[model samples]
Target: MSKIDFLVIESDAARAESVVAALQFLGYHPQRGEECLVAEESTHAWRAVYVGGVADAAEAERQFALLGAAAAQVPLLAAADSPWAARLGAAGSPFAQRMATIAFPLRYEALAEAMRGLYARLLGSRRGELRFVGESAPMARVNALIRQVAPFDSSVLVLGESGTGKEMVARTIHECSPRRDKPFVAINCGAIPAELLESELFGHEKGAFTGAISARKGRFELAEGGTLFLDEIGDMSLPMQVKLLRVLQERVFERVGGTRSQRCDVRIIAATHRNLEQAIAEGRFREDLYYRLSVFPLELPALRERLDDLPVLIDEFNQRLARRGLSCVRFGASALQALAGYPWPGNVRELSNLVERLAILYPQGEVRAADLPEKYRGQPQPEETRGAALLAMMDARAPAAAVAPAPAPAHDATLLPEGGIDLKDHLADIEVGLIRQALDATGGVVAHAAKLLRMQRTTLVEKLRKYGMQGSLAA
Candidate 1:
């Protein structure tokens, strides 16, 4: 194991010595509070902060705060006897909520277990703009590859299924590289028409073609001294591939319909969902271009291939939603089990969409297997069986007197009248009434109203459209 840096903030000499000894035994480098404070200007990121034997809560808070931003990014581990441990474990403060408490005497076994969990969490947090939120073996390998290739300016070819975050990997490489201060320009080769792609990549001079009214800088010039991400490179036409190949080889490109060759100093990072090798065999892609682009190949695994990462990914997505002022949602055990069983054809993107939709539908609610969409609830037990099991479990936990008898059916459950009724219209009317109430309660905010009714915003919008109530409601 590598030597992880830990900041130890303890006032008692004996306790501080014991803490440092245990950290060294666990193969971690421990820096004293005074030492860390003196080296505050250093750009070192501590893996965790150890708080033990502080005089009181006030002194502990002051010393912890003094560690500054370096301490803020990492985990906090407090001893059981530490004066501030109780306050740090309280619910109000966000930082305190995440702090871990250890044994007072600092038993190695307990300390190791706490450290293990925190280390895994620390690994999943942000690394620059790279939010690689997974600790699975596949993701660990991907992160290792990124670290190895980021220092060099070699061409990287990222391969993954659609929605598997190929472009994210490309951006991570750029963000981790030495040229991160420069711009990162991206162009989707497949999205642009063949005629316009050349001008999009290599700028056209003023009046060079029909619509070339003004000269514009292309992606190569825009990404000078940084990275140019060519997405869906497999879709580039044969002629365009030839032109791109020339630029890759010579590091120079001539604008469309221009004689002057402009030198480019940009790193090339290309990605595609298609199999370039298959495209080459089919004679649809240039083999030479493929080789040039794949100097360092990085492949991202589909979400289904790494199910262990589901929980972390969901938490990261919820944090993102919360940062945007949207409500965060939590999934119950059964809901998570159902989600794990799902085959995510759309990969990470689909999961992200589901989280956002759930945030809109459930708000700060705990979602169960039944609450999930039908497609996601894989092979769930019948409602009758589930209800019986739930009742049995409740009976086992609660006293006989505490369990109330079932209530009688309500007035709304009365039999239909003799006159034939339009069941569809009746149901539609009930839905409209509920929607109107939810809308009114939320002051016409569709998203908030959707949460109140436990439905998606888009679903509510469609209902409003079908009822011809769009004009009356504020969207």
Candidate 2:
């Protein structure tokens, strides 16, 4: 009656009632159904689905197929005694990796445990889906590696360029892993000073150093039962590498001043822009430490290498900006072509920044090739130049046609005034004036005003809210 938290699909009326009772006992509201026929809206409302009393594995598979995308969005819980549950629980089974199988006749403890696991997994899946944006071959491989290695506690070494989103990849792995509910502590080894780096990683006891007035837990202790992301790890000093190697080997560490050794239960996920293998060869990084951290090395391809994913990445960035109440920007064909040709030396992070910058510059507007920063606009295509030249020649040979004089250049100021005005305020005033004029011309009809201004009605509504003009304007 109140929003359904769990949807139980069981053909057997007695088994369905039993599952519903168990769910209610666990403080969950559940609705029982004979088959998987959840409405589209209900799919989002429900937390998980329980499939039980299936005649055989074939029936279960058929039910699963019937569930469709809902199966991917929500966690699936199956009766352990069911014929398909055995196969579903098997290693490498796609369903087994995501679905939680609870033993029946559904003991409270087992059901609770299964629910807890599925809830954490649901959150992790959502996070992973949102952050991992690209579908390019390189990203597909990277995602596959994350899925394969996340379940295990093997140390992960993510290697990439400075802005290639190595940390994001590490976080995705941690989110997809069993430890998603735990703290994901991160520290940049390269950012901190060498002297302070050891203290930062291992912490210190009271009076360990001049600044240590109180005892503190290090990243190893703080990230217990979770993930500890050590970013830019290749820059760690040789001394620190030896200490880290010892911890990796022994799984124990002592505070900077304390004698008691603390056991670390943290999963190590280290990322670096530098080449650690080269660092090892150069005697900067220890070979043993490198070997320990590189147990499962993952290489992230640079943004330039995955050019096909640029549009998707840009769209993802625009969506993020929109969430922040910023107007989204649309890139034109020429702009996209220019972006594709340009080599993104700064990678995804740079693109994200660029998108935000464009949102601010051209809010709710289309961005042309000329609107882009000079560096990002690559040279014009030779074919385009040739076509233009041919058109010009043809025009010269044809009959002379009187062309109207070009309109005056917009905002024709050639120099800044000695006491410069607030350019943003000036632009805002101009925009407000134009919007008011559009509204007046359209008899205060917002839809007509938006059409006149060549913008979406929603975008215009947002502008009205932003400028506090909604009450003054008619619908």
Candidate 3:
């Protein structure tokens, strides 16, 4: 195997910036240019070292001695920029003169070249860890899809309401893919103003407009050879979509101001909640761009549909809040039931805010049902819960009537220690009966009956599965 690349050390913040720019331009991701150089040197046998300056002359000398003893595995380059360098040079380090003659104030272009040549010896590997940590079925499905798709380079469109963790999914794809070592940059299309959105995506040359300061790399440039996440992409205007479409079809794009076409190999992963088909029909979104982005689409199911994950999400949030020292708070049993019952119109984002608020206000005790937000209190059965909206959508043409209702007695009516039957079984039976009744009412049109049952179609499927009759229902 080829050896690892060299380390680029710098004295101050500005020097670090210059060196980093040079290293990146030269295609080497430089290790920390700070005082941790010796620690890193010990851990990852670097091929070469660039010593800009030591942190403190006296203390640095002591640290340097530790490093000199540890650096037997690699070559060291001590750029002569400090008084300490002169001292080290005089200490009979054999390579001191060869390193010292390279001028201290190296030009940017020259520094970039040198760093490139130094890194050319090593074969690059993917940089860091890629992880996904949710056990929910919806999340598991997303992870599975990401694993399946990560080996290929293609534009991906993630469809979901906000706070559904679309960005996490996008990152998981990039991290597992061949471009894992490359940058995974993200930009919010809706956050920036419309006029500024274009320049932000493609970047602009200096003096392109009134506020132009210096030439800058946009998210695309920063994500070269990697992935770019265009969040809330539906919010981008028609004109910008056209330009983005051009880049997708052809791997070349022009900066906002400069006419020079820069060719880049970057995978694009876009996300949005808006119905782009409707937008395209309305002449707001471009059809070509829609097709390009939707080449691989993944829809994230809403939290309400995955209510079984509520407990998992709450526990995760509790641990996260505890790290911030809001440790004592926990959801009461009733509070949890209340959370599961609510419609969660805002989905996971709403749940997160409520959890944070509970942690802040009632940090040391069980949060009571009363502590729950007013909207969720005193819910009716799911059938009675969702209003009359479903009554208006049914008709006579739909077939597939509900199967014969299993009587309430066949339910898991276990005789309790002090009672004749388990109430849980009784209630589940009632829910099952209600679903069957709704299906019978609608003649089994899932959508129409889902409205009548006052539940999501997916929820009804799960409920049927719990009773071991879901297969018949699906058919």
Q: Give the TM-score of each candidate.
A: 0.57, 0.57, 0.57
The superposed Cα distance between candidate 1 and the true structure at residue 413, in angstroms, equals: 32
* Selected candidate, larger lDDT, 2 vs 3: 2
RMSD after CA superposition, every candidate: 19.3, 14.4, 18.0
Model 1 off-target regions past 4 Å? 1-130, 382-475
Q: What is the TM-score ranking, best to worst?
A: 2, 1, 3
Cα deviation at 145, candidate 1, in Å, is 0.3
Kindly list the per-residue Cα lDDT of model 3 for residues 1-475, writing each as its tens digit: 2222446555576766766566566655456534453444324444456666667666545544444443443334455465556754675865433333245465553354333322221111222233444677877787788778888997899999877778877877876788865666778998999899878888899999999988876768867887889999999988788888888888888887899999988999999989989999999999889998988999988888788888877876775554333544576555676678887879777887888887767655456454456787555333233322233334445443623332243223234445354456445544554665567566666676677766798887776555544323434
Q: What's the distance in Å from true for residue 295, model 2?
A: 0.7
Worst-scoring 10-residue span by lDDT in model 3 = 117-126
The runs of at least 3 residues in candidate 2 whose Cα sits more than 4 Å from the true structure, single-residue gaps closed, are 1-130, 381-475
lDDT for each residue of candidate 2 in 1-475, tens digit (9 for 90 to 100):
3455577767778778878888899987777654445444524245678877776556555645554555555677888776666776688776665687776565654576567556545444554453566899998898888888988999999999989998788878878788876767789998999998888888899999898999987778767898989999988988888898899899999999889998889999999999777887889988888889999999999999999999999998886665334668888665787899988999999999999998878774566565578898787433233233323333223554533333343444445758775566445544565676567666788987787678999999998777656643765
Best by lDDT: 1
TM-score of 1: 0.57
lDDT of 1 by residue, 108-159 (tens): 6557656754543344354343456688999999999998899899999999
